[model samples]
Target: MAHKKPGGAQWWIVAAFIGPAMLAILIVNVYPILYNFYMSLTNRNGPRRFPEGMYEVVGFDNYIRLLTQSEFYAVFGKTVLYAVICVFFFFVVGLSLALVLNHPAIKGKYFWRTLLILPWAVPTWITAMIWRFLFHGQFGPINQILRSLGLPAPNWLSDSFWAFVAITIVNIWMTFPFFMLILLGGLQAIPTDIYEAAEMDGASFWQGLFAITLPLLRPVALPAIILSLITTFQMFNTVWLMTRGGPRTLPGQPGATELLLIWAYNQGFAGQGQRFALVSAFAIVVFFFLLGLTLLYNRVTNVTKGAYE
Candidate 1:
């Protein structure tokens, strides 16, 4: 039989099916990013100024200000710390849960799996609100339990360190389930024979985990880790809802828990003066930073995997 190439009609059909989605993406995603980049170069301060066309192109002033400002550096550092802590805990907890569930002797695996994923199933806003109440200063259950136990109850939201801890706890609770699901899938994909071989060779659990499981799991886990890192880096809703990024220790600085997205939001909308241009510059910087990190991560993971192979 002769091979026939797709004709113009087929190409048109393909484009017809893809055109709406492509157009939507361009308008909804691509256009806004480009517009924000353009706005970052201008001195537009507020919504009113945006429409007036009176905003002057300030060039690199906004970028320079963001890069030079102590406040920006503080927030950026805190955001990176938040991402690292959250992603680290997420991996540890998620992998532990997956390992437990993956054990051959475990019963009701489906039921346990379902229950474990409930946190991710809930809306993040609702989870944030619940955690907020739990972390309430006096009447909250956590404090009540602490007082009952004859222990001092620290004010969670009003104190800087506790507020940071509270936000981190809430974020970990809400996000660990996602990592659990991803890691569970990875665990199940591993061949039972590899593990059995390690066991037959008298490998201990920890030895097998390090020698057999981890190396095999890396390929599956790395992408999920990167995704979790990005998600945690841009986290805003849970932090905002829980503390409003508060327990501010410094007079003119962001709250201890104010990650990059929340800082940008405060700059753009929450503060006394709207700093649209500054916010845009911050967004541009964050976009490029994340882009570079992602590229570097992928490159490193590929190199490591190739070396292992």
Candidate 2:
């Protein structure tokens, strides 16, 4: 295919249409990122004893500290763990649900769909707060229920491992509706004739699913899955709300629930003068990690090349 050059008039029209969008993208999305990048090289945090420290131009000093610190490494590891778990389960659970919800004979489908989507409709911060109360160590509904049933009720927010598990479950619950809706749309778009043909071939449901349905749905859902993964990778508010990063003693780390976002939050806001630049450095690292993941996903899935005919 030959690239056609846009003539002068067309270029003007293109700019006319694109001008507002580009402006919005820059102001709303791109500027903050660049600002953070610039801030990453400064020392923006300290005690009142060092007011001069705020404006100090410490080139890559923050980045050096973030890279060399064991606490930072632990946080990064936790972030990766959280992202991996949430993305994996979110994909599986969301796709499975979307498949089931799209079934032809499912009764009260609209009602069920609406109910399923309700969780997503609620503000995530509010949901997180609610779940936090439900998972409270003393009077939480979870423990109460478990106790009533004569079962062990693990501390959902206290223990480090369980806190991660709880975070994953919350994330999965919060995000499944999006996947359901996307997959539902994809499933509806699939050609019925293909399934009919599989039936004619006496193909089992599983065979048809693997051979036809998955390949067909990939194109529609792949972008959504990628997007969800990206968002979940940078997840912050839910876990923060749930535990306030939790009881400090359990993990024996510098902070509780040592995910990158939370760690950055602690660094930026915790004790004295906010370490905005250090936080920015950590944020920059996370941004690259997510960007790398997106690039890898695109390469593996050929998402940009148009996967479906």
Best by TM-score: 1
- Over 4 Å off, model 2: 1-16, 48-54, 250-256, 296-309
Winner by lDDT: 1
Worst 10 residues of 2 by lDDT: 45-54
Candidate 2 per-residue lDDT, tens place, 66-174, comes to 8998887777777677777777787778778887887787888889889999989989899998888888878999899999999989987888667877888888889
The TM-score between candidate 1 and the true structure equals 0.90
Off by over 4 Å in 1: 1-10, 46-51, 296-309
- Output the lDDT of residue 194, model 1: 88
Residue-wise lDDT of candidate 1 within 73-171, one digit each (tens)? Answer: 889889889889988999899999999999999999999999989988889899988888998888899999999999999999999888888888888
Residue 199 of model 2 has an lDDT of: 98
In order, the Cα lDDT scores of the candidates are: 0.86, 0.78
